[model samples]
Target: MALRPAPVGTGIVFTRIDQGNALLPAAYDLVSETRLGTTLRNGDGVGLAAVEHLMAALWGCEIDNLFVDIDGPEVPAMDGSAAPFVFLMECAGVVEQGASRQAVRVCRSVEVIDGDKRIALTPADDFSVDLLIDFDNPMIARQSSCFHGGSFAFKTEISRARTFGFENEVAALHAAGFALGGSLENAVVVGEDRVLNEGGLRYDNEFVRHKTLDCVGDLYLAGAPLLAHVDAHCSGHGLNNAVLRALFASDRNWKLEPVMSALPSWSETAVAAEA
Candidate 1:
């Protein structure tokens, strides 16, 4: 896969090189599935999977426009964290297009409830996330995290948190065509009573941190930076997408706000090459 620069207002687009260069805009309305991870499909039925991590990295890096060229159905699961992608962006370098940035500002709260799980977005001056997760496994009984958006905060606090799974669910997940590429090298494996990874958790609350990372990625599908406070509990990819749908259900829920400057860590003007 390659990350290429896009013209201003291009947003984030995934180009399926292997599928005749089918263009799939990374937008919430195009989301086709969220069983194991997020998937976006075009009108041709061409689809891409596991885009959450990469999307999160783009959001964290403040990459407003880019073209992702890939040859497979899923993004590479490098370390199962957004950290690698962040590094790639740093290596590729970010340049601000000569255009003002735009954001989706929530005008009111929108919520989705499913049993004990729920997610909501409310008006805020900046993007932030408050997320919590609960699992039956004692190793991850309950974990909570909050993120106030910025490249530094995401890279240092959220990007290194790797995806995790339960040992017992491997077979079922495999049968369901999920996590076919998952392994100890790419994901944290929780065994009967402990983390099976050699180094254990990156952070004491890494599980929740990773979930927040995923939330950041999932929410970026809104097509612009969000100026809102996201509150979620036991939310996964599906619920994240559902909340986005709810947020855009009415014109009264959000408005686009234009910022006259570029994000920090980037020049106010320049051009970027494909990386």
Candidate 2:
């Protein structure tokens, strides 16, 4: 797949170049599946899966409008992290268009609970997340990560953290047709007592960091940048998307705010390109 710049207000959209140029908007309303990953389906029932990593890269890089051209049903899982996508975006360069940035500001807290999994969003001036996870595996007994969005390095902290799975579950996942492309080169495989990957981990707390990264991508489907403090526990794509739905179900819950001085890193490039 390839990503290209779009005009102002275009938002993020995926185009099936091989399928009659069908376009699907990357919005929560179009989300049709979120089992192991997030999937967006267009009106005609076409879908694109494994989009969380790409979405997180776009969100982190402050990319507002873009067109993704794909020829398959799922995104290429390059390195199983957002780093590859981020590198591509950087090489293509970011350019701020002549339009005001916008965001959805939360007015009240919205929460979703499915057994022990929980997710919530509360009013805040900036985007932030506090995530926690508990697994029976000793390699990842309990891990937590907190990110004050836009104030840290997404490249080093989150982009390199790969998705993890238990060694014993690899066969089942493959037999079930999930993670068909997953491997040690793209995922962190954990055994009963140690990491199966030769390269250990990018961070000691990589588990929670990657989860936090996934949460950021899932919530981006809200169709706008978010200005809210998010707290989640043992939640995956399902709960993450649920909180976004709940937050938007009520008009009183969130309101769109025009962003000022958006895309600072890309402003120079934009100006230079236009000149």
Candidate 3:
């Protein structure tokens, strides 16, 4: 996939180069599937999957507009984290747009509940995420984390956490036509009593940290950076999209407002993209 600078208001659009240049806007309403990963489809039924990592990187980089040119069905699951994407963006450099950035400020709390899983967005002065997860596996019984969003914080704290899966479920996922390219290099594989990766994990609570990364990416589907706090428990791609839908269901729930603060120092520099 190639990332190209876009004029203001272009938002983040995906061009399906293999499918007649179909345009898929990364918006919550267009989210068609959320089984294992989030998928967005255009009117012509062209869909793209696993976009959460790259989207999270874009949010971490404070990028407002870009065109993603991809010739595949999903974004490259590079090491199953947003770190690679963040590195590429830094190498390419980010440019501050002429206009102020807009944000979806949550005016009231909105939530989605499915059994014990729950996700919510509520008013906040700045973007942040508080998440919790639970599993019966001894390796990951329960983990919780809070992230105060910013470029440096995201890169150092959340971006390198790799997506994880269970060793026993690999065959079933494969049979279901998912994780076709997933492996130890791009995902953390949990065995009966231990992690199957060579070096163990990047963070002690890496699993929950990775979930926060996915949350940032999934929430970016609001078409802007959020000026709110996200609270999620036992949530996944499905509930993430559902919460966004619920947040926009009422005009009183949120307001689109311009961000008045100055751009962060990291984005102040302008650099040339390599050939």
Off by over 4 Å in 1: 171-182, 260-271
Question: What TM-scores do the predictions have?
Answer: 0.94, 0.93, 0.94
> Model 3 over residues 118-197: C-alpha lDDT tens digits?
99898998989999999999899899999985879999999999999998898688888977765888999999999999
Clashing pairs in 3: none
Off by over 4 Å in 2: 174-182, 261-275
Put down candidate 2 lDDT per residue, 166-258, tens digits, no spaces. Answer: 888997888888767547878899999999888798899999999988998899888877999999999999899989989989999999988
Decreasing lDDT order of the candidates:
1, 3, 2
lDDT string for model 1 (153-207, tens) is 9999999999998888876788888768657889999988999899899999999
Poorest lDDT segment (10 consecutive residues) of candidate 3: 266-275
Off by more than 4 A, model 3 = 174-182, 264-275
lDDT of 1 at 156: 96
Q: After superposition, how far is residue 25 of candidate 3 from its true place, in Å?
A: 0.8
